[model samples]
Target: MALSIRQKRVRRISGDPVDGVVVQGPVDGLATGTPLYSVAVQGTIDGRTTCRPRGWRFGTWNVGTLTGRSLEVVEELQRRMVDVAALQEVRWKGEGTRFVGAKGGRYKLWWKGDDGTGGVGVMVREELLEQ
Candidate 1:
């Protein structure tokens, strides 16, 4: 099933209602280099609101021979309360999958990797899907 999402525009005190996808949970805790997209109207949502921090967490990992470094990212994210994460350059470091999987988040694993050079992985907590 496709989830619903909510989006608050830049500097807006309120969050605009979006259908089919809602942004919830802890976004503030997301790690650096997380791929956050500006919410776009998918099914015609009407609301006068702006984008603001919803306290959701995200992460991004630059993959390489950094098998030793993957854990570092997860550990750091844990410390920051990051609920979601994007791991870039994912290669031999199965640790990224394990880390996000262990978190038990409503995660999405994609292999946008380029021969272990410019790959990206994204992780999202299920709680954050609810607006």
Candidate 2:
């Protein structure tokens, strides 16, 4: 005997109209247990409505310690154009935000840890700080 499996179909629901925009229907070919939907944004740029997609690079790493190698880590991340990163095992005591890297390429490090042995941190490119 052969086993048969059935996949659940995701139903598309119409969202309430906002700013004269009505979002309806689901994207095709992305059927899964959870429903996935996309939104179309119409923004005015100098009296023009434009729709564009923005992208960013992300990374994750378990740095042994950030005591003396913080700058090095920032340099590597910049070289790879990583917009945001989730770091583990930072090994830095206390929680605070600090600037790292050289003049041209800089990143803000937000870290939190009780002791100096285990911690987590997030590094974001300086250019995207305001956003």
Q: Against the unseen true structure, what C-alpha lDDT does each candidate score?
A: 0.47, 0.66
Q: In candidate 1, what are the lDDT values of residues 1-131, reduced to their tens digit?
A: 44433433322223545433334422343334334333323333355443343455444555454445655655565666666666656664233443233554334344454455555666555456454
Tens-digit lDDT track for model 2 on 1-131?
A: 44222332322344522222223223221111222233344345566666543445566777778889888888777766667877888999899999998876889999999878889999999988978
Model 2 lDDT, full chain set: 0.66
- Listed per candidate, the RMSD to the true structure in angstroms reads 9.6, 9.7
Q: What is the lDDT of residue 9 in candidate 1?
A: 32
Judge candidate 2 at residue 69 and give its lDDT: 85
Error of 1 at 89 (Å): 2.3
Tell me the spans in candidate 2 whose CA falls farther than 4 Å from its real position. 1-51
What clash pairs does model 2 have? none
